[model samples]
Target: MIQNQHLFHIPVMGTGHSIDTPIRIAHLGINSVVSVVDDMLCEKIRQHYSSVHNIAYQNIPKSAADGRAERITAYLNLMADIVGQKFDELKKMSLLEGTEKDRYFRLLPESNPLRKSYDKIASLTNQAVRQNLIKEITGKMTLGSIDVNIMAKVDALKMGDDGQPLSSEYSDASSALRGYANSKLSSSLVLSAGFNPRLYSYLSEFKDFYRDKTGDIKKKIILKVSDFRSALIQGKFLAKKGLEVAEFRIESGLNCGGHAFASDGYLLPVLLNEFREKRNQLKETFQPMIQSFYESQGWEYPELSEEETTPKITVQGGIGNNGEMRRLLEEYGMDATGWGSPFLLVPEATCVDELTSKVLANAAEKDLYLSNVSPLGVPFNNVRGTGSEKYTRELVEKGKPGSKCPKGFLVSNTEFTEEPICTASAEYQLLKINSIQESDISDEEKENQKNRVMDKTCLCTNLGTGSMIRLGIMKPSYGRQAICPGPNIAWFNREYSLDEMVDHIYGRRESLVPKERPHMFAKELTMYVDYINELAILADPEDAEWKKLLRMKKNLDAGMELCMEIAKGSSYEGENLHSLQSTVEEQKLRLAEIFNLVPSEA
Candidate 1:
């Protein structure tokens, strides 16, 4: 049902980096996600692109009712228009060398029948037959989905100026969903960062989410999950309301960019294996519930085939090369692979400014680490030497810390004030720091705690600053950009063209990473090892902590065993399969050190 010529998609980066990715590359038949978390960012991008495309633009002011949803809808509609125009033009272009049509087919996977057909047709000796076949092939061409993402947890309740909470419909996540639902774009809405009950319930209100009379879903749902159990749980909940999840996008908990949702030590390969084994259970469990809901509503449930009703299973997070991607498709049975962090370097695809782009390009493995910079209290993947890091530290040195809290999207704390405030806000930090100094604790411990408190940066605004800077909407001096790139970013040390990156994905080009780069599974194993090692060091696991740590240890051990089996099996080139064995053996030693420090569970 979710058919596309290409095998890979660009996952949502930060709130800003891939905000306008569809406008840039959807015409090329490559799917990409836009984060609708910050509607102001959407409005700004919409305004900028509207000018660039010479389209009439209208500003949706903040005071306007349903402004957030309006902003998102307007931006998405504009993108739909622009991408539609470009794709139509590309389809009409001649199949000459270096033309868009040539690039479009050339970018398809080697196994794609259309690409193979294009190659064979291009070699036809007869002009008339070739021309007719070309028309047929071009007619079959489809546009890449202009998908959007909603971080379900960022659904903060909005308040009116009269000091009363707005209706649940006006919440952050609800507004975003409303925006996408109201849009004219026929694409999927990816819900990431765990599930929200209210947001999930709101999906039932949109008629487009349901199967039409012709058994077509005008707009689909893609749940970005971390494990098989999560996929089953979330998928069933949506299905109970007659909402079908078109795809289950599995992302590595720790190996991904943005907020790292570390699982209970379940590694990527182990998770994938579970999904592979139990992928059928997802549809089997959801189908009946969906049918029941439709029947209760007195709506006809289309007699769709099983394949059409089945949810797609795709994987992302730290997918570095073609070999890993192929294994995910052939070995583990994924629908498609999502290449995320690598696209940060592809300017034609992502919107990263020059200053932040340089930092991402030259960053080494050591420079990229899991940081505590996110106000959501989640571990964020961060790089060193960014304008944001420098600015936050400088403010601390100057006796001023935290952001101005211009955008309160991440606000969830209400420790001192009646109204909630962001942890990265200046007022909250000042109050927290004063409270910490007044507490009865060791000087050294207080300093450490204060440093952690000061580390919370303005991700709500700063994440979008790079896009603003890149678009020339904001000056460099005003751009305190905060970028989140996964550890896989270290292997790529320079900018890449869209053609080069797409070619690399299909194995038409040579490996972009170093030969020493670890396999995605092996790399994920090391990160989990480091995570537990740090936890084992910090955790005073006298009772409950010991049990949690022990449970995590068991999961890690099981994952390592699976990795060993995979390493011993047949491998594709550039998979770095050997790294799995070595990494497992090496990490076993580290695990031993951690357990040595941690006492056995009672």
Candidate 2:
């Protein structure tokens, strides 16, 4: 396992929010992931940083040969260079009070060795001894990794000017992978969403993914999975190709930001319990497969200890406070936890313009919801008063309800056009609306169908506009910024400095969330119940959808039972363990009513 100095890492936010996070915070020894979904956004940010640092700049035009991959490579290399320089400068500074070096040690967990050492050496009377110890500690300081993320399924096939589809290697995800593989970064590549066999196969081409003589993988693999079964399946597939999964980062489906990949009624606690109990099975099942592949290729399989070969299991999503974080790390045996949505409120961490930041800060629980805004048709965690929401709604009110489709990253629809166009595009919506109007269905049904068709917002461009607007790359008038923050953002009602946010994470100061906030486990459970209830209402009685809903109900019942046991176990102050018990009862009664009203499949 790669040794992370921090107990928690920031997962990738929208394509641009965390794009430059490494440059902002990696010198402080905090690991963060950058999204490589939009190469155009990357190129712009790279140009901005290059000019700021007075580095030589060159543009990779869209029509250039292998431009997507080249652009991503250039941006990542620039990021690596910038982060290294910043870290070197940070290490050279004296440990003066309130200095950057002081902030670095102060942000660390109280139990961390460096923090403890700094604490002990602060009161030393002998200047010579103190300076010696400080030098030794500074020499041991490591730079936080600048990891990159690729949504595995966001691989839209590109088209040449001649209108012919590009080769499979030129797809969105493939080019992004190649870009990362070619970069100088020695960090992990987090593959979120789901498995794409073609993308996984492409990993075999990159030698960095394999082990070297020192038994170290230069480029590691971290699969952001929702459950244990997914980990086993994808892990084994990669293992057969001699690619080891370094970590399985579990995230909540409905409770997370960005595109929600809702699981089949599998709650976070139940999922973590499975991984904790079956963690050994992962290594046991993959080691032989990897060894066999290595032997077949005449490669030396390094004789490493079991600890090095075993994959790290981590969890993220809706983790609000230290108590919940402790339960995830200690009780569930998670190696680390992820803190995403709350960082949207931390200006020192993520990129949020003044207008959008205020919206996220003042957003009530009712304002943050699971929305149908993604053109990909995935449920997205969205805030109420985003500029994108207002713009899209205004367009509808004016009888013109669709974007012009400038960027086609999420284009998957080929219904009306010979080539695929984004459903959020004006062309597609108009085509779809006309068909609905001419159909024989009732006016009410037509309106409902039209509403669903127009629900898709242009996420490919809008999601990244916040960063552009904040960085002065574009005017706020032209930037209809869309931000996806989880429901947990409701409790954090103000902007925070980087130190304040890190303090909240380490429990070094007062809690940032309110007392009325629900526990993470209970919050996820309630979401699953509400989700199934919605499906139950829409599902036809005799269809296969109803059967699926029945199975989800059974799974929720079992999950509630586990929640009850957890509530009875150990209670942390302000964690609201009692609320977990009450939520189980309340949601269970609601679930019973929904199912009772809908008949079971006969």
Candidate 3:
């Protein structure tokens, strides 16, 4: 019952990982989600593709903006100009007579023998006109249907060169939402983010809100949820606002790439089951609230058919092969599966450097680990021996602590001075390192803390550098690149063409992914166990760390129980069931040992 033809989407990888990704995917008649974190890159891509394809250009609101409204406005204006020029070109082409029209069409193809002559003539004749037209509309028009990410809270806010607060535009979640709304882009824009009530309130202020002309709200916004509880809370909140969510993007807490938001122990299968079983129950719970809201607003509630109202449930994270893809869609009734990290291996799909791509392909389990690398303070998934890490360590050895703070996208804290700064800024690191040295912790602990601080590279800049470097657009002084791939990426041992990857997804052909890779459920459980064990080693017995450990233990127990239930059922068979049972038992023993170490309550 998946309404959309696209059975898969490429999640926003990073600033540069998937730059211009939509263009490549759209060329192949596939819809792909590309990141708009870098505005210039987005504008360039839009300009290039506006004439060729009408693909949805998605943006991630990961790092905060300095002048979000102006930036977005400028972006829309540029797109309008490009789209306008495309229309003009089409009109001109249409006016061509029989032979001329045929010649033009023939020359349009790259394989045409006289394409060079046609390009020369067109460039000479229309270059000035196109440039003037673009200049005229570059700051005036508005565009529709761009996607934006609203990551619940600001991880880092960009600062002005003068060190004064940039416009209130970049201040908080509300400002970001308002910036998009005021630009008249809200109507067509898809607001995506984790569930946040404050953000919901801001979005509700829009005249159209989530409604379409047909009375049913359009499926434009995406909610990133790990479990049903979160989805229910978000759904009810939207219903109360007379708004409707189009999709619930279920991501695996620990099994995904980039920032790993480890769930309390809810596995992907368990969460998907809840959504499938209670999908309509959830809609029923929200329908009344939605009707009440519409009534209060003196508006008639648009009664939606079941087809329009049923929320699309899609899952991402650690999904590798055609088997897993088919199971998630057919067995679990998922609308689409997101293939993220694997897309990094397809040069046609992502902007990874040759060296970085090879490193990712050759990576093993040990190379990938959750580390305190992001300045956002999230548990980011990082690979070892990247240029970023090596450069960071070299800087630490040379008495420097942090990155150059080039692009201040991740700069939100002002802990070290009156001006807000990034935790990964050199100034902040020097001050923090000094303070940590004076703390009461052991020398070893202090050293470990310092290493953690230094480990944070300027991900904002480093992540974007891969594409620029690969395209020969910019060369960095560091001469190294950083890559963030989920542990699932380790199982993909070779580069893949986009067709091969797509084939793999639809069971046409299997490539890149290894046959012996463990089931995603087992991998996630093992990762959680490892994460808890690491926390235990660093956690003081009397601190809140103990409580965190307790929560993790509870989640692991829940996950184990769920796995056991699945093993006993008909969902899995043979090797899959054996792997599930064995992994659960192994994790259970490890959990028991950790639980025994916990001090009894008084």
Worst window of 10 by summed lDDT in candidate 3: 137-146
> lDDT per residue, candidate 2, 279-308, as tens digits?
999999999999999999999999999889
Best by TM-score: 1
In angstroms, give how far residue 88 of model 2 lies from its true place. Answer: 0.2
Tell me which of candidates 1 and 3 scores higher on TM-score. 1
lDDT at 328, model 2 = 86
Give the TM-score of each candidate: 0.98, 0.97, 0.79
Per-residue lDDT, model 1, residue 450, is 97
Sort every candidate by lDDT, greatest first: 1, 2, 3
What is candidate 1's TM-score against the reference?
A: 0.98
If the candidates were sorted by their TM-score against the true structure, best first, what order would they fall in? 1, 2, 3
Model 2 pairs in collision? none
Candidate 3's displacement at residue 196, Å, is 3.9
lDDT (Cα, tens digit) per residue for candidate 3, span 1-602: 11233567777687678655643443222344544445554444444454445555544343434445545544544434443444344334431244422232332223323333434444545767744543433222221123445456552443566776554335555555555555533222333446556667767877655555566443256788878898888888888887777778889898888888877767777788888898887778877887788789788766678867677788899887766776788788998888889888989778888778878988899999998888888788888878788888888899987988876667767777876678888988999999999999999999988888887888867887777777666664545577779998888888887667766766555445555677777888988888888888878879997888888788677778888886676642212556678888888888777666433210
Off by over 4 Å in 3: 1-3, 27-29, 40-67, 73-147, 155-195, 216-219, 476-480, 568-577, 597-602
After TM-score superposition, the amount by which residue 532's alpha carbon in candidate 3 deviates from its true location, in angstroms, is 0.6
